[model samples]
Target: MADNENFNSRRHVMRVAAGVGGAALAAGLGVLNAHAADSDGGRARRHGVRTYVLVHGTHSAGAFWTAIGRELALRGHRVVAVDQPLHGTERFVPAAYQTQDLRALATEPSPVAALTLDDFERRVTGVVRRAARLGGPVVLVGHSMGGVSLSRVGNAVPELLAHICYMAAFCPSRSMPSLNACAASPEGQHAITPLDQLVGDPEKLGVLRLNWRTSDRRDRAVFKEMICAGYSDVAFLRVLEGMQTDESMTAYDGRAVGRADTWGRIPRTYLRFGKDRTVATELQDRMIAEADALTPDNRFTVHSVPDAGHLGPEDPARVTEMLHGLRV
Candidate 1:
C-alpha cells in the first residue's frame, strides 16, 4: 500500500463493487494515502527484467497480484500488473444507465459480422506490440480471458515472448465455438458462469453488460478473499469501481475456423489446477491434446497442482517456481 494521496484523486464516481460502502472505501483510501506517501516499493534491479506485465482475467483487477508482485520483486523482477480493459468508460455506469445503452444496441442490427480468426489474431498482436515497446520478451502469464488473448498473441508473434504460461486458461480450438468446447467436455460444462450472472449476451456477439450486483455477503466474502485478499483496499476498490462488463461475447461466440499458423513457433506451458472449479483438469488435458495434435513439432508442457482452484498463481511460491524456469 502506498500513501493515501495516491488514491484520493476524486474520480467521476464513488466506489460501487465488492460490498464496500462509503466508510469502508474511505478507510481504504486513508490507508493508501499513507502508503503512497512513501515510495513505489523499491526500484527494479539494473539489467533485470525491465518489466513483467501480468494481465488479469474477467471481473479482476491488477490488485490481484499483491503477493505475486512482491515475490517477483524480491527476486529482482520488475512487475507491472494491468487491469485489462473490460468496459472503456472511466465512470461507473450503473445497470439502470447501462439498460438504456443495451436496449439501444439490441434494437439496432449489429454493424459488423461475427469476428473471424483474423480479428482475434489482430487483438492479440496489438497486446504484443504494446508489450514489446515496454520491453522485449516480457513473460506473459495469462489466466482465463488473458489466456485466450495470449493464444492469439502466441500465434501472431511467437518471437516476441520470453515465456508464455496459461493458468487454468480459457482455450477454444479452431473450427469450434468456445461454448462448443465448454459443453463438449464435462469439465467445461461445469465451468460455465451462471447465465443470469453472465455480463454479456452469448448470441448477439459484441454486447457487454454489468451483471454482478447481489448483496450476498458470502459471495462477496469469497470473492474478496480469493482474489483481492492482500491488495490495498483503496486500490482494489478503485479497480472494482473501474470494472465494467467484459466483451467476451465477441471474443468467444463463433468457431475460430482457421488453425493458427503461429502457435507452432512459440514455446508454451500450461498449469492445470487439478481442483479448478472453473477451467478443469479434464478440459485442460483436452486443450493440451488439441494443441499437441495441431502442432506436433512444437514443444509444450503441462504441470498439475492439487487443491488450487482456477486462480492457482495466487500461491506466490508455486507461481514463482513455475515462472522462473521459462525462457524466450
Candidate 2:
C-alpha cells in the first residue's frame, strides 16, 4: 500500500509537469510552425522501425515536441508526443483554455488533489501500448520529471522500451528516494525550493501550475525565458493558468529512498542539456549512475548539448541527428 501510494503521488507530479505549458507557451514558441517539415510530412518511408515517444519536462505539454516529432516523421520514424493527463480530460482541459486552468491552480489557495498509482500506471501503460501500435518497441525520451515517469515505467514494463533516454533527468538511487537525486544535485536543489512554495504542496496536482513562481523578479524573468521564448502575453498567461501539481511526485521522490529498481532490463541513453539552470550536469551523471547500477545489462550512453538548456529541442536538427543515430 505504501508503494502504491508512492507511485500514485509521483505520477501526478510528473504528469502535471509534462502538461505544464498552456496556450501562450505553445503559441509563443510557435511550436506548430517550428516543426513545419522542410520535406513533405511524408519524406522517406521507413517502416518496422522502433517508435519514438517524446515526453516533455515541467511546465511543458506534449505539444512542446511537435517540431521534433515532425522532423522524426520526415526521417521515416514513427513518433508520437503524448499530451499528459495532468490537466484532467482534454474537453475539460482543451488546449486553448488550459492556460486559465493552470493559473487558477498556481495562484488559488486550495488543498492538493491526489491520484492512485494504479491509475497513473494504467495511463502510462496505455501510452506505451499506443506507441507499440504506432511502430514496434518504443524509444522513450523524457526530460526533467518526465524522466522520472520513464523510470517508473521502465521498472514496470521494461519490454516496452527499445531505448530509454533521460535529458537532464532526475533519477532515484538504490534504496534512496527520488527527491534525493534532486537534493544531492546542484540544479535540483536550487530549482525545487522556490517551486515548492508557489504550489504549497509539491505532492499535489497543483504543482505544475505554479512552475513560474519565483520570488526573485530576475529569476522569474529568467525562468520565463528558459520556459518559452518569443511569445505573446495571451499565450504566456494561458500556459501559466493550465498548470497542475502532479500526483506522481511521490513515485519520483520515493524511488530515492527504496532505490527504484529495473535499470538493467533495458537499453538507456542520457542527453545532458547545456546551460540548464534546472537539472544540472552533475545530477544527470548521478541519474546515469543509478540507472547503470540498477541494471547491469542496461547500457547507458550520454550526450551533452552545450547550446541547449532544459528546453533542448529548440534545434530540430541536433535532435533529428540523435534520433537518426539511434536507428536500428
TM-score of each: 0.63, 0.67
Off by over 4 Å in 1: 1-51, 87-92, 95-124, 133-136, 175-180, 183-186, 196-211, 217-247, 254-261
* lDDT value, candidate 2, whole model: 0.52
Top lDDT model = 2
What tens-digit string does per-residue lDDT give for candidate 1 at 1-328?
4534323311101111111100001011100010111133232222435345565555444555556666676665656655444222222344443454545433343322243435545644665566566443467676655566667666666667767777776566753335334434554544423333322233343433333333556544444443344445554454445344333344444343214466555677887776664555676777777777777777568888876655563346997777766665
Number of clashes in model 1?
A: 12
* C-alpha positional error of residue 116 in candidate 2 after TM-score superposition, expressed in Å: 5.4
Error of 1 at 310 (Å): 1.3
lDDT of 2 by residue, 1-328 (tens): 9967765655444333422211112312212211222242232224345567766554455665666777777766667665555532221232322353544544443222343334344556677876555435578777665665676677777766777777666655663345434544443443323232234335444333343433456645655554433435455455454444333433333342212345456667777766554665555666567666766564577777876655564556896778667733
Q: Model 2, poorest ten-residue lDDT window?
A: 21-30
